[model samples]
Target: MANLYKLDILSPQGNIFSGNVKQATIPTTSGLITILAGHTSLITMVSKGDIEIMLEDNSVKSFTVIDGFLEVSDNVVSIISDFAMKSDDINDEVIEKAKKYAAEQKQKNDNVPSEIAEKNLQKAIMALKVLEHNKLKRKKRVKY
Candidate 1:
């Protein structure tokens, strides 16, 4: 049997996941990094990307992390994120509506804060990307 490491993933709202995982792939500012058991203790800032975790059952779970930090020590990895959610948590319809609303607001309200608009746009885009990735994976599985 493969060794397992503890992975605790947390969002600003609360803890999302905590379990024994075989591996975890996180997106750092530089690039994607994969961690396994016996990985060195370190800390790094995570980018806006997917965090893929390989579970003990050989299933892969993905979470979208907007901006966050990760700490690894003693075969335990902890992730604290500004925002984090499983790919399944994002609804395509909801994201589409939010994108449309942001576009309308950007056009109608000149007083809207640029930062707010940017944040909304980024979130909408990220949600769409996650949804699309899941859709493609489902399609591929169906074809096989």
Candidate 2:
């Protein structure tokens, strides 16, 4: 049997995920780290990046998180993020719209463009990157 651990991810909106996972990879301020069934207790700041969760059945799930905190204790992992969403839930059309809005904001020639525009642009860029990476991963899986 594969070692399984508890994983719970929460965001301001609501609970994102809560279930058993074989392992999980998280992006922290120090970089990426993979936590297994018996990982030592840890508390770390989560950076904006991709988080991968592997289920006991070997299925993989991915999420993109903005900023958050992660804690691991007694085989349970908890994550609280300012923003988070499954990579599969990301919409390309939404990302493109964000980019276009940011560009329009910049074209306004405001010495310091709108903060909302910048944030939207950044999120859009990150989502796009994750999407691209997921595509590559899927392609690699198909080739094998």
**Local distance difference test, per candidate?**
0.90, 0.88
Residue-pair clashes per candidate: 0, 0
Q: Which candidate number would show the highest TM-score if scored against the true structure?
A: 1
What would you estimate as the lDDT of candidate 1?
0.90
- Supply the TM-score for candidate 1: 0.88
Per-model TM-score versus the true fold: 0.88, 0.82
Model 2 agreement with the true structure over 1-144: per-residue lDDT tens digits: 548989999998798899999999999999899999999999999999989999988999999998799999999899999788899887788678768877887787777546667676778899899889888988998999
**Runs with alpha carbons beyond 4 Å of true place in candidate 2:** 100-117, 141-144
Error of 2 at 114 (Å): 7.3
Instruction: State the lDDT at 43 in candidate 2.
Output: 96
